[model samples]
Target: MMNDKSLDIETAEGNAQPPHLNFESSFPSENTQVQTNTSEQRSAYQWYVVIICMVAYILSFVDRQILSLMIEPIKQDLMLSDTQFSLLQGLAFSLFYAFMGVPIAALADKKSRIKIISAGIAFWSLATAACGLSKNFIQMFLARLGVGAGEAALSPAFYSIVADLFPKDKLGRALGVYAIGAFIGSGLAFLIGGYVIGLLKDVNFVVLPVIGEIKTWQLTFMIVGLPGVLLALLMILTVREPERKGLKVGEDGQIVKASFKNSVAFIKTHKKTFFCHFIGFSFYTMMLYSLLGWAPAFYMRNHGLDASQTGYILGIIILVANTAGALFCGWLIDFFSKRGYSDAAIRTGMIGCAALIIPSVLFTQVENMQLSFALIFVAMFFSTFPIPASAAATQMLTPNQLRAQVSAKFLLTSNLIALGIGTTAVALITDKYFENTVMVGNSISIVNAIAGVLGVFLLYKGCQYYRDSMKTENLSKS
Candidate 1:
């Protein structure tokens, strides 16, 4: 392994190279060390950081997803329409979550990612607890915004950290492990949230110390949200930031400090690639969020199940199907990468999207519960492909300084479309077009069909664009 002095010299030597120099010739020794380290495999501490990051991600999703299972009770208590509830689920959270990521990720690029992530985990956990204290639509909306803002700090920073920790060969699996946290957390939210709802089913309200009387759903938020604070502390104490790799250099032989503007300029240099990646993955996530945010309600209303029952079933499906899919997709990306596919990430995404279309649209259209669930399992399995794919695509091509900012940009586009538009699009169609509440399944099917088709087409194009972008980075074999 390269020591700190050798690493500094490596960066300095690269900076000493001329502008427009061939990338492969600019850092021969660094490239050799990279190849050597790939064979050395990752250390125990590297895996430890990945595991801790995964835990944080798990908590983040649990807090975010628990609200889906509580739709009926929350709507009843707050006197909200489907549109209003959709705003809480989609617009209110996503608006801040998406936009805030850019600025927070800029900080992550320059600052200590571990600290940034720790602060974010602590803040979001508290915000999630605050969701329990919400008395009305506006209050819940505000609390959800806080949750979004806090969570905006996590992924961009985590992606940057993980990329620095692992080589390209092992990056997909590490990120895949982290991505599975989304499913694990969502699963727990549903499974445990269901069990809690069942326990609190007979009781309408709970009396807490000083807080007095509150709905059981409110208590559920508090239950799942608070443990994250401790996790944040654990991270702060244990995980040290890894050395930044693949940094860009200025003509003056100094490391280039990244800003949002620099990040955007870099994207413009590979405009077609990012356009396909950002927009394509946005459509994919549109299908994903629509399903995740509404599937519980689909089971409840369309399939004649209650909240607890819907939670239990969907939770199990999400846990089993989505988690496995994330892991398998990560390995699949590595599988393709090992075979010299420069567009492995996007290629994997296209495969998953193609397989996802029928299952996503048909799952809700089916009348039989077993058939619907089986289809849902398949849809969910493919839905997760973007998790590792998106991360790997961004990290693989971006400079270390700009990785977080670029990731934040992708998050902005993705969440805006997926959460803000996707979730609300379903509600709008159901309320205005269908003119019925119980026809949510139809709305789900329509959105998934449209989004899935667009997602596949764009990703298919993305494979070529991604390959071209890799060539631009001088990382492609072709």
Candidate 2:
């Protein structure tokens, strides 16, 4: 339940004059009376918002993952090495994506979130299509950088919208639903990309006079990129911006704006939750980046499957396990919070997941292909199960006004540390152990396991912070 004082402040928007900047509120107060329908009506609208955001998110992942499917074809055509491929996959995309998220998030906070999201969809979609036109490694790398830049705007805006649409109690479920887009988009990219590329193999199309005939992979990119344009149009037409919360003038007559300095101050004041979330997100990205970026290649080389077959099998695992894990984590977090164990849910989930990952990684190194596939599915399930908890914890720690910026900051920190470092680290390790494929596989398992353990410890600390915060709030009320 919302605090009575908070609700009063929310309702008194027109009655109370805006507070001045000199006000000493530790957190920004809810000032805007967002035009919302009744609870039942708003509940229905929230679902609609979630659906649209999910589609946008789906498109984002589809654009991001398509490159991995084309890595082999691109490498063969461009005459590139694994190291070069790794740069295209990780560093090139992550560096710009990480840096761009902040400014994009700031824009989302200040502008219409729907517009930012729609523009991002179109931008990344075009960038993906551009990938098919690249003549060399450098061109492909630059195209990927564009794709990353576009994607950097998505999650922060989407998260802020979700927070606005749903109440605190229901936010976990909403966010979990949003997270499913990651799985669905990634799974579909592999499944559809493989089939599309297979059909287009050795085919020629006269799409452009200057470019003349285009091959299968190029056509695949163009086909995939075109759909996002339509999705972007839908977002612009359908989604409405919610009223900004926590931007109200308090009794002191000051209007609150969430600035970068304010965001940093909030984190500094909540250091434990801040650092724990950062570390947890880093480890999460390490596993996800390594898996998504390289799993298809792993299947092609180790399991002796063609791209299409590998994509289908992996898609099945992702569709099933990732969806289930996301839903399960949301349900568990809410349930545990009701039972007075808010942070325990996340801590327990991560620790158990870490334990499961060790064996899953070991099994992935097994020579038997069937056993390896089964283990990979198990690994993916456990690996993603804590995502809801981690996301929820981040949202819970920050005030409403700074939600987008904080979420973007979280992504920025995590991406730099995890996606940037994790994928590059795995590639370097694989290259170093190239003389022994067994050692390469083993090294990935070891690095991921160690990271998972560290994540567990961080989550425990997050739990402590959460508990202390709750106690402090309770005391203040008393």
Candidate 3:
């Protein structure tokens, strides 16, 4: 491996040749020891890239998740069942979002990531706004599917972009900061959604000049979705695509395409590690999506807090607590990884499972409302803790050629199961078994416990495989 002090110097100097420069002179590098210049990778333009990507990530979550806060309004508006609403929130979105990731990621692996991201941002933003125009459940469902398809193009590109932009030493922190979009966007979705709801609550209807005749929830979707269009334009204009380092590059300064077979072969070579880690993350995602998707409903049903009130409290907790936890976990992983404890990332994943299991399961059962809020806040923090470390670990394991596709496969499988299951399992319990909306709290507890147990088991089993994978990379880089 590159000496710690030398890499640190390289990082601080930020004056090395771009890694692609080396790859351009060579082809099919077997060693994958990319000597990226810290100067180029850590430049002002580089940081600009991460910051804008973070903003775009934040907006994506806002557009996608605003529906969670508007669940009741949408339910009443469309005259739907909890199961049907859950379909809109869960399976309908996940099916397209998860499945579409593979092809889009394959595209990202060969094409310009910025084009995919910018165009996707514009597409999803418009799709999110289209939800505002839906007068029926089918129309809303189809619009959400469009939103999912657009979002499918992002994360593969996002992770791949960040991996190329930052070196190994700084990747954890950078990705963690980027991952904050997940929590922060969700928080802002609630915050902005709530604030919008409050504004329109007293008024019967809102009428804009060009787009006349909209309701409260519809107005909220338009408010949250439209800004992203402008953000997408800014992204394409400003965010330069990072050169694909440690791989073959074309004359256009892009990575030469790797076949889908090559990506699958890579995964096949490390089946145990990839499978266990992917499963662990999927289980973790299950617990997370449930809390974010249904917690507002829980607050409304059990604690007598309305949408605005639930949004304010939960939004504060998610924005503050989850952000702190993600950054701290990122720092911890980087610190330990630098010290040669290469198992740091997955080990952190284990710790996150422990932290979330009890708190998340107990939060809904707590008798006191204040204590319940505190517990849920704690739960949210730990739920976010695994993301950065786990993602950094995965990125570290692969070369640029395989990174985006591997990430897409992980996203595809994980979201299909977790998003499909996590977001809907609670509602299934409430709608089918309990037959009461107030029973959503019980559903949350049950689902969290199950997924937590699964996460702990899978992550534990993967520890040795993770260590072995790290050692493999060390040898190659060295």
lDDT of 3 at 392: 80
Cα error of candidate 2 at position 389, Å: 2.7
The whole-model lDDT of each prediction reads 0.93, 0.75, 0.85
Candidate 3 lDDT, tens digit per residue, 170-280?
A: 888888888888889999999998888887789867888898887889988887888889989998887778888757355599765676887897788789988988989
Across 1-478, the per-residue lDDT of candidate 2 in tens digits comes to 8899988777767555565444546555453223333556777878999988888888888888877877777788889877788888888888878889888888887788889988988999999899878888889899989999988878888877777776556777887888788888888888888888677665654366777666677777877887998988998997799976545343477755768877787678777767877777578657766777777877787667888888788888888877777776677666666656656445645654565566556655788888887787777676665556666766655566677888888888888877778877777787776554434465567667877777777866777776676564341111
List candidate 2 segments past 4 Å from native: 1-39, 202-210, 246-255, 348-352, 436-440, 470-478
In the range 282-333, model 1's lDDT, one tens digit per residue, is: 9998988988999999889887899889889999999999999999989998
Stretches of candidate 1 exceeding 4 Å from the true structure: 1-42, 250-253
- From the highest lDDT down, the ranking of the candidates is 1, 3, 2
TM-score-best of 1 and 3: 1
Residue 477 of candidate 2: its Cα lDDT? Answer: 15
